[model samples]
Target chain A: MEEWLRGLRGMILESLARHGLPFPVGRDVCTGWAEGLGLARGGRRILYTSCMYQLYPYVKSVTGLLESLGVHRGGLRARMAARGGSLARFLARPSGRDVERSKAILRSIVSLLRRGGVEVGYLYEEEPYSGALLYELGLEDDFARHAGMVVEALAGRGVEEVVTVDPHTHHVLTRVYPNYVEVPFKVRSWLELAKPTHANRRVKVAVHDSCLYARFLGMYHAYRGLLDAVGIERVEDPYVTGKDTSMCCGGPIEAVAPDLSRSVAELRLRRLSALSRTIVVVCPICLANLSRAAVDVEVLDLAEVLG
Target chain B: MSWAEAFQRASENAIPRTGMVLEAYRYVVSWARELRKVKEEVIRDLDRYVEEAMSSLRAVGAKPYLARGAEEAREIVGDIVGKGKLVVMSKSMTAAEVGLRQHLEGLGNEVWETDLGELLIQLAGDQPSHIIAPALHMTREDVARLLRERLGADVPDDADHATLASVAARFLRDKFLRADVGITGANALAADSGALVVVENEGNARLTMTLPRVHIAIVGMEKIVPTFQHAVMQAAVQAAYAGLFPPTYMSITAGPSSTSDIERKRVSPAQGPGELHVVLLDNGRSRAARDKELWEALLCVRCGRCAFHCPTYMAAGPRFGAAPYAGPVGVMWAAVTRGVEGAGNASLLCLHSGGCREVCPMDIDIPRIIQRVKSRYVGRLLRTG
Candidate 1:
């Protein structure tokens, strides 16, 4: 998935340059304690928050690629238990190593962003994160304590925006966090941020609407409209579950129903094929699933299409 | 016929129990939100674009009249139509918004929709659900069935694609040759050159304008652009939005299809129409143009992209709204042109996705406009309450 995502990101960057649109690249930071212990220096952690993590091979591949790209492995599990539901408590078992690992990963991600010249911010007060585990471990205030240090560090560097793909992250930073951080922010999908620099010379394509975009974010048509403006002929995908009626990409259900997930992906690909030979997807999970399905069509991210 | 009577008849024919009205309202709200997000730079220069379009139309030897209302537009069209057997057309939702077809037909002339989709709709005895792709909801099987019923036993169910194409081709070819006049909607009209841009996959529009001796192009006043380049850009955007390969073909008719190729002295014997007429219908466009927020609805290129992406449209199919216009843009257009009471209620189900805005080449924020319409509807309800 990361291989594909990286390819998509590269395409978007190229397209943006071609179209004379703005493209900003930078680093981000998250400061939170796992279990009751703070993260030690030089520790490793695994981060799994996005629904995309449920897809095993794809997640493994993306994580491996990110690691190869110099990303640190920590125990930071960024997993969402349900759609807009609570974070998993099982991962919060008072194992000091687990906590330390999670923190290390978060720190590494932050460092990566900083190195890339991007600023970081945090909004970490929702769901189980604000519930009993941190409190039970008697380290409830550790998140705020560490977050303050990171925020201060970021402020001193004049970093303005904390770019995040998750709406929860955006909601926390913008609305929940009490830091009164006045930094202007951008909450967008990786595809939106990394649009290609080249004009789409190819005219015919179909967009497979992502559930996150259509259902949670209400952005089903915006992508289509943007593609249209960029001179790409958009064909209608009959199986698109738009907005409230959106169908899940089966990323979430993959843990319990892998076959069902694959079937859904196949069904979606078939519908998309009816529309066009080129299928442009917006979500990381959808890209992974459809790519794995081996559908005999060119699969691209919307940003890639723009390129 | 008065617009009031026409509207009454449309209301009677409307599938009142269907969910179209609610779905259309929802689309308006969604599109309105998107229009609001358009960059200020684009919104600020709208007047200039309008002026440019008006000038181009005048330059091409086409008259650009700004009618204040439907009644005024009726008088203008009535004057042009005269008593000489009113051969009518199928081109715009604006015509449907104002009920021009029935009115002209009532004035006692044979009216026909020459475009294959419009003709199919005419034969099916249905109203257009989308501004473009009017028959998008119908499958080939439905068309085959309808054709079989209309053409009788001679039409075969197992007929190949070529045979079916030849059938409709043969039927419309005769209609085109014999029609006294042809009417069409301008995708974009250059205000500076008075050139009319007609984009279509089929050659119906070309035949419609050229075959008839008297040619008429009807367009909303807002369809005007300042220059040919701007019109071309808009056309490209429309084609992209409509999901076609730059539209199967685009026809730019300046005056009529007259050519000097027939003679060395630059004289045409029988090529193109002798008289070309352009009707710049205002209907309720002027009213919409006055409101800064709702005015951008006039910028629609009638590409049908918004409807194509609309969730409600996908679920309810084309019959989801009132005649002439359907989907999100249609709801607002219907309201403005048809009346708030008559069409405002049609767009109650729109989800505020801001998708329509993102796709709009002109970047019209449709969701915001729909909200404004909803507010007006709410205010009216309050007043009555």
Candidate 2:
């Protein structure tokens, strides 16, 4: 490991330990999205966002600021940047519009589940970050500790089934967490749980599959099924949207290599835009990263598109 | 060309070819599954297979030597070829693994890479950028310039692909005619029949081995399978998954050419190479096989499909891994051949997209292996720092 990535991992573990999140953002940002959704709290089944959807806007701002300031190359500057916690809190804050958009997408997911007769609750502040970044970054020890805390938090809330909203969160809960800890909850993606009535809009859109959802989690068909039920005609190319060949938004490398991440996202956006002006994504990371690169095309969440 | 520019060109040209392979042979998926099982069976007891293969080769009059590591393998080969011999080589990643070509050249031997892509890479004084297409990073324009500059072959600055190939062909035909030793990497070595299988698109490998009086094959221990049928299956599966299905040619050589044509009695040096030598290189492969999850990497057939599908690989070109080995599978190979530290921080470049595992014919869990490497790398960093 290089000094920069090592320093970044150190800083992230500290943040996760101190603030219960990867950033210094408070619990309000994690639970604020469910304000008027009228969902129950402390129930057996809850909609677990894993703070991915809420934190993505902040991720966008922070990665942009770090990239522009040339903090990607680690040393004194990067270590200094990581230690400037207060400044990060200010810079990591999402805009008012971005906050509302995040809330709106979550609200749409709840509504779709409700319409499909699948009533779900919200964990609010009790929901823990899935510790996906910890696992993905290869901090297995830290991830194991964090996953233990998350499982404890969910169990305290009497949560037995977690309906996840994004691919990264859904994947950690469904596949990765159990290996590190005793996961007591049943993990399900909203794509599998939601069955909203046909919209009959008959609109054509390009779908950007989440690498986790499409390949690792076996949810590719489920996502396409959601689009079909909503009456959206998917315009796909074998190279662009092939089940095996779909491109990534490069979210996984954003923290370590921002410039390369942006270039990859731009490339993916270009291929997707050629298929349709409206590009739909199933993961929050994809939505954030792709939305950053989207100029002429409209990048929307599958939840937003479904609503 | 820069890494980014090369990535763009390679992806533009490579993606469609893979798509065509996938569409043309839907049976490739089932074939890959069968190959995976066979590879798993062989890797389960690699040492046993090595002993079986060595004895079988000896029985067929082909000398087989198992070199414990890279230095030993290089030394053995150096002693065999001696100094001032002419050696022409077919494209072999295993040869690149032990740095054979440079070693032979270092010993005052004339060495030429017969594969067109490798020949270009050799002429350019560059390392191979891809496993199958060694000079994939170079465009036709780059090839024209290299031929014009290094070989001083008469070629237009804007020569087409065929013209560039012909110039290389005419240049290499002479080397093939006069070469004393032909060296190659085996695709699969059969322990049951003492056969060496090679899958190729061009006829260069066939000529390289047959025309020379001395033939030496450098093989990795992992290329061994139990039977001749398994070896052939391995070749077909590798070719199909590599998007070069029904590979234009496949050569299965069991031993040095001999004939009982004269009064039903065998005679040596009948045709082809009078002597065949097999050098099996371990070089940390057996050590790698002992690892819990990393042992899965030994089953890889080097299809190179994983590189085309990996975003970081497409963006960084050869920068993603050590030379000759690049992309996701390259990370594993580098970690094996070159220690964990030698693999560098390139493991950080993996996105954990899980795309490589999906495309892998061997069903190796590359993402898990990469995570393990990252974990180990970080652990080493934490301890040493």
Candidate 3:
């Protein structure tokens, strides 16, 4: 194994050690607020963050780990490819207003579900990653072990259902988790959980479908359903949208081969930015990566638009 | 060329064609299930079907041979079609797999690739980029340049395709008549009836199969189906996936064209070829078919839609394939037929988008297949190192 990939793996394992997570525990402050709300936990829904939005705060650590291992940086694309593997994409740390924006979106989702007469609770810092990276990178044995631990943890909470914020997590929990071990709890994308409430924001938005959500979860129309309910005008790239042909956000492999990821992101954003200045992204990784790559476009979480 | 650059170049030609195929595939959505069942049955019991096909073809006076691997298949082809003869070939991905064209040419036969795309690729001294449209990576400008220099045929630098095709057609038609042998790869072979089915849009396959004195079909062992009806249905799957309702022509060869109409006597030298030989090439397929999941790839009808819809394949084109195979199924095919390293490397090109599965008529679950292959290959490499 390459020295850097091994080192990056060590760093991820360290995350699990320090915070019972696979990413840097960069202060999940929203979980504290959710805990204080004392929302009924036994009431059918457990709000799961997938730790992606929290990982947003620590994503640079993977790159920092890469440079520390002497993997030289170049341009954005070349530098990404220099990292040698996909271990780094675990962090899609949101920045600026996006952090506060991301937290607000999560808070709004809980409130929206609450308004709809549903109960929501958090595992706080105890939430583990859905082990999506391990599964995706072909570390199935590791993922299987991790998934067992996760199922045990979630099950111990007496959790009846899971409200996942990210598509990768939603897919792993819904689709992948069952194959390894029994997932007794029902997993739903937060988009499925949150009913629309007026944000008083009336602007055109392009819907950038999460490949995991739209293609894997068969949620192509589900987002449109959510968007439609929000009473917002949403635009879709005709060629790249729909159930069969939705384009990827290029965030999945950002750490494995940065250049390829960049090129994919550039092409996708170029096409998307042509349609609308503000695009509604479905996953935090999608929001982080696309907003980073956007030239003159605003990338927002779907919940952010609704909130 | 770099894989990314190649895909960018090829997609200009591929994307529109894929759009058309996706549209056509919607109409035949029902066939995918039927074809999947047929592929499962035929592939799971492939060896038994091969034996049945061998017996059935032999009974009809057509010689059949089961080759263990690529070398044996190439040697069999070599022995049958000897030196100092002109050979014309139809478009065949299997032929590409064993390097048949290069092997035949090395054996002193003047082989004229008859398919228009194959002919252009042959003239250009380039590798075939697509299963059906072999020269899809080449622009008209590239084709014109190659024709002008290699074929020495007068074609303008910016001349459109039709004119360039006509010049090549005139040159190839003469070779077609004089060729001593013709060769093709079967889309599917009917084990029960001893029939060889070849589907193509061009008229080349029909002429190649019938015109020569000796006709040879080099087919993968897995192409065997239980019945003629099954073979035709598989052909429909292939055509539909290629974005065609059906090819312009379908040629079903039932032994050599023999006639008993003349005075109650069946002639030895029939209307078609006096000699008909079917080479069932295993070429690691027997080993692959034993693999519980990898074998599903052998049941693939080579629709090209999986590759067509793949984002990596769209970005990388033929470069996305390892050997003769490309795209998602290509990764599996390459891993089994070629070697693990290239296939493992090519596997990374895929984004795990699941777009191919959505379009796959068979619902092959290609992401899982690629991942499995990658896991095995990486394990082997680490152990060896």
The candidate that wins on DockQ is: 2
TM-score (C-alpha, index-matched) for candidate 2: 0.96
Better of 1 and 2 by lDDT: 2
- Candidate 3's error at A34, in angstroms? 5.8
Q: Model 2: per-residue lDDT, tens digit, A65-172?
A: 677656666766677766756436656567777778888888889888988898898877867888998887777788888889999999887888989999888888
Q: Name the better of 1 and 3 by TM-score.
A: 3
What is the docking quality class of candidate 2? medium
For every candidate, the chain B TM-score is 0.79, 0.97, 0.93
Runs of candidate 2 with Cα error greater than 4 angstroms are A84-90, A198-202, B1-29
TM-score for chain A in each prediction: 0.45, 0.95, 0.84
DockQ of 2: 0.59
**lDDT by residue (tens digit), candidate 1, B283-320:** 67667676676777877777666664443343344433
Candidate 1 Cα errors over 4 Å, as ranges: A1-307, B1-59, B83-90, B158-161, B256-270, B319-321, B339-343
Q: lDDT by residue for model 1 over A226-291, one digit each (tens)?
A: 577567877763334334223334332222223434544555565567677788766545555566
Best by lDDT: 2
Indicate the TM-score of model 3. 0.89
Could you give the fnat of all candidates in order?
A: 0.00, 0.51, 0.26
Ranking by TM-score: 2, 3, 1
**Candidate number that wins on DockQ, 2 or 3:** 2
Which stretches of model 3 miss by more than 4 angstroms?
Answer: A1-11, A23-44, A57-98, A236-238, B1-27, B339-342, B379-385
Candidate 2 has which clashing residue pairs, if any? none
